[model samples]
Target: MTTYSEEMEKLGQVTIFDLLPPSPSNAFSIGDSVRVVITVESDSESYHYLEAYHPIVLKKRGEIIEIQGNQQYLVNFAGELHVMKEHEISF
Candidate 1:
């Protein structure tokens, strides 16, 4: 019989994102116009677990300025730049 440690070792490290389906926003490219879909707190407990986009970015529209890989994007909201994830934005 396999021990709990052995099973955990086999599973390795997994995050919630890994268990969820890929976001359609994953296909977003530079120059795409997108809008922030969710508000995240910079001081939340889950802040470390996910990207923390400022509340100001919530419901704001921006253009994708760069693709940071791993589904992260650098967006230009007016003159300000913020890094966001695919799930945080919509077309």
Candidate 2:
């Protein structure tokens, strides 16, 4: 596992580890609240909160498609892939 500071460095400028205690990391335990922001960097910065925990795989290039039911989103991240649930960010 990468430390919060180390991951921040890897992400370069797309994210920040701030506004919350860096204990739980990206995985949110029950009753845990956290503040996270992912900036995809386009015309402007995109900021939002990431739900505590639920497995998420991040990759530079991935496939995105919408499924009808059961598995709603099928994502191919890196050479390996997995199923993931939807997530939202708080302002």
Q: Tell me the tens digit of each residue's lDDT in model 1 across 1-91.
A: 9988668767886657669877555679889999876534534443433345454455458899999967999999877798987777889
Highest TM-score against the true fold, candidate: 1
Clash pairs detected, candidate 2: 28-52, 28-53, 49-89, 49-90
Model 2 lDDT tens row, 1-88: 8899778777874544464445423322222222222444521222322113322332133344333233233444444343333342
Q: lDDT at 39 for candidate 2?
A: 44
lDDT measured at residue 34 in model 1 versus the true structure, 0 to 100: 94
What candidate 1 gets wrong by more than 4 Å, as runs, is 1-25, 39-56
Local distance difference test values of all predictions, in order: 0.73, 0.35
Candidate 2's C-alpha lDDT? 0.35
RMSD of 2: 16.3
- Candidate 1: worst-modelled 10 consecutive residues by lDDT: 42-51
